[model samples]
Target: MKKLTRLEKYHMNKVSQRSNGKVVAITPEAMEIEQRAIEREKRGHYRVAARLWLQCMDVASGEVERARIAIRRQQCITWSNHTRQGEYSGIGCRGVVYD
Candidate 1:
């Protein structure tokens, strides 16, 4: 099993706390899409992860869920190294501009 990141653990804790540790129904399709997005994020493919996060958000069940996914998408976008041509790359978002 992949070890959970700090952010993932934080989300799990808050979600469990919110519902007394009970899980609501999750659509398998949405879960699958979420897994793919997470994998992309772990591989440093923030652009792809952002797209998958948007898809996951579309299938999310409630406002809170959608909001969480939107947060993830935004994080990806921030780290995506936005370019003048309106594209993203794996370049780390540390103020390095690639031409």
Candidate 2:
């Protein structure tokens, strides 16, 4: 079993405290999946990362957190599709050039 990272431990504690210890325990498998999803995101495999993130969301105990993850996953998919089609153009908010 993979040891939990500091961030993961913190997240687990926060969720537990919020739910008064009623939520499911954070399993090593879920952490492993999250790690893999992060790796995929870093490698620009956004579709794969989004899918893995959805899996993580499914295993997450909090409805609000799951919704947040779903939104993030959708954003990843949108960005990935746009980037692949050369539609990003390095533009930031208010038409500012980021690069």
Candidate 3:
């Protein structure tokens, strides 16, 4: 059998506990990540926000928290893709590099 990484082990444990109505308490780091992701999105750093939000999802306390993070991540992903497309089409903003 393949060895399970820490994250994979956590996911497996959560999946098993989920059936027993357990909820994992989120850490302070999870909250920090959520805040950072929000700030990044506000600053139009969609790609960065998307990645942070994905990390946040991994530490989310429950299904609702995960769902909220999922929505934010999806929105950032769409915005990131749109901006990239715009740059590719030579319609980038004046004096603003996408990076």
Candidate 4:
């Protein structure tokens, strides 16, 4: 079997946690991170975007950013819980939540 490339590995890492029969919300913070990334790319600030993106993951700080990240992480957990419970109620829950 061919080994996964770096890009594929990155994609897989992001999705792996969600593949275990659970939902994951993208959250406003994550969306903001993504938006910033896009803006950075547009302004040719790819390195800055990359740094910000990494900071958005699992660990981040700054009172404001920390709060935002915590809220988003909670949203992701809530989403997964809702999805699991929905399975019992027969409601089809699909996709990430970001608002």
Give lDDT for model 4. 0.49
If candidate 3 were superposed on the true structure by all CA atoms, what would the RMSD be?
10.8
Per-residue CA lDDT of candidate 2, range 1-99, in tens? 577799976775565223433222254555667778878988999999899988987787655556556666786799788666535546454566664
lDDT per residue, candidate 1, 1-99, as tens digits?
A: 467799976665466323432222255667788888878988888999999988887887656666567777888999887533554555776566767
Model 4 stretches astray by more than 4 angstroms:
1-25, 59-99
Q: What is the lDDT of residue 6 in candidate 1?
A: 100
Sort the candidates on lDDT, descending order: 3, 1, 2, 4
TM-score of 1: 0.56
- What is the number of backbone collisions in each predicted candidate, taken in the order shown? 0, 0, 0, 0
lDDT of each: 0.71, 0.68, 0.71, 0.49
Better of 2 and 4 by TM-score: 2
C-alpha lDDT (0 to 100) for residue 98 of candidate 4 = 44
After superposing candidate 1 on the true structure, give the runs of residues whose Cα lies further than 4 Å from its correct spot.
1-26, 82-99
| Model 3 TM-score relative to the real fold | 0.56
Query: Between which residue pairs do clashes occur in model 3?
Result: none
For model 3, where is the 10-residue window of minimal lDDT? 16-25
Judge candidate 2 at residue 74 and give its lDDT: 85
True-vs-predicted CA distance for residue 40, candidate 1, Å: 0.6
Model 1 scores a C-alpha lDDT of: 0.71
